[model samples]
Target chain A: MSWITDEMRGIVGKVMREAVSHPIALSDIRKWAMAVYWPEPLPRQYWDEDYAAQFGGIVAPEDFNPFAWMAAKPTPDDPPVSMSAFRESELGVETPDYKAILLTEIRARHGAPMRPGDVIRCVWKISDYMEREGRMGLMLYTTLS
Target chain B: MGDPRTLAVGDEIPAFSREGTVHHWNRFAAVNYEFAGHHWDDDVARHEGFPAPFAMAPLLHAYLHAMLRQWAGPSARIAAVGIRLRSPFLKGCSMTAGGRITAVRTKAGETVAELELWMDDDTGARLSTGTATVAFPS
Candidate 1:
């Protein structure tokens, strides 16, 4: 039996196409942290440059915008049935553009990862969007489901 | 005392590691929605020619994040982190979580630090590698 189901696939497709945004907050970050199988007591150092470079940089929370982030990208013509498609298509929705609707509860674990037959529901809401001014510019606050 | 806060590049961070068993795989499978019948079902995974049920890449990212967060402290915010899955983490296999500081800089008046990270098998085979950036309280 597969873990990813048709209905869930449709839901993922629908979520990807929607023009929505949420504000990023420190608390929201914690919630995401708690949702995962985190080890007790974190390390005492940051991830080196090679790892850090993957994130690129933080998107200004105040300047956060998704439409501009997607910018003329084509929506998935079909529901993604494979992880590669999901990453190449939907995940790219935030690629390059750091601004994204942060999904706090989405956690992956060691296993066959989701299979084709699994069906599940994901509930998310707009968390916060704070405005901050810094020497660089205005920071936008936005998080997503 | 000398600066307890000054961390030079190349300083090693406290590392932690763990191994996943079929139980861990099963637990992960229950929550994940992308498994295609091969995970936790040896018949399925074997029939599909998979050595064993493999861990999800994003989950690997989560584990790495957990390692960094534990180091940064409770109040620290994760500004950004990224990881690339290089090898598979099979059921009943162990992997180590470790990182080292590579650079430190200032941006927007905040001290930003960078780290190099790796998750390896018991033999020290690299499964995933990447970096994390965080801002600590000044």
Candidate 2:
């Protein structure tokens, strides 16, 4: 049986959620670098401003996620956005039930570096969907970007 | 390995490794704000049919980027990174991420190196594999 539904396919390119982050902070970058490289000293560019000055200034680790927590667009007063994806209900589409959701892959493309005082805006959408047979059973994977 | 400008295909770059411990995962959760129960609670994990709580997928992806940054130096631009998770890096395991140069070419004013990346746990299981591109100024 196919997991893909007409509604799910129709909203593939539509925006499901959008968020704008508050200005990024230096501590935010420092703490992220520290967390990613715990027990070891991170590169100076991530922690020390003077050392980072050689490259311009401090920049967040390229893989940093700005939408990890709260966002300005989806104000704190607004209902929470579930961490899990495939919630087409939010976009007025019904979703098929599944036992568990697993993140199978991640692809990131970088252009400009994220630095302190930078405000970031994110638009979340369901880019694609596919089903594969696995050990558990028929698994449906949704690609959100 | 001195200037990144002389990088050649088949060169294995430095790696970033870390044990699967809450000591480190908690820190990542703090910054990333990922408080998913399955990541730290064995019971929650078992309920999901996993052997044990495992490392978050994003953290594994970040480790690959961390390895790239270590080798590319502060100035090199990491153009892109893509990873496919094959197995969970369960708690108590050790993950080491490394990559080898696959292709190198010049673009505009930068030299970009394409790499084949892999993450293997100490248990000899390949946890994830993917590719990346890092560009260094010429």
RMSD vs true structure, all candidates: 16.0, 1.6
Candidate 2 lDDT over residue span B1-138, tens digit each = 426557999999987789999888999988888878878999988888789989988888888888898888899899899999999999999988889999999999989899999999999999999999999989
User: What's the CA error at residue B86 for candidate 1, in Å?
Assistant: 1.5
What's each prediction's TM-score?
Answer: 0.52, 0.95
Among these predictions, the greatest DockQ belongs to 2
- Per residue, candidate 1 scores C-alpha lDDT tens digits across B1-138 of 112268668876777666666554444334333344554566765654557776655456667766765666533445666676656677778888888889877666556677888889886678877777766655
**TM-score, cand. 1:** 0.52
Error of 2 at B65 (Å): 1.0
TM of chain B, each: 0.84, 0.96
Model 2's DockQ?
0.79
Determine which window of 10 residues in candidate 2 chain A has minimal summed lDDT: A77-86
**Candidate 1, superposed: residue stretches over 4 Å from native:** A1-16, A19-35, A38-145, B1-4, B29-34
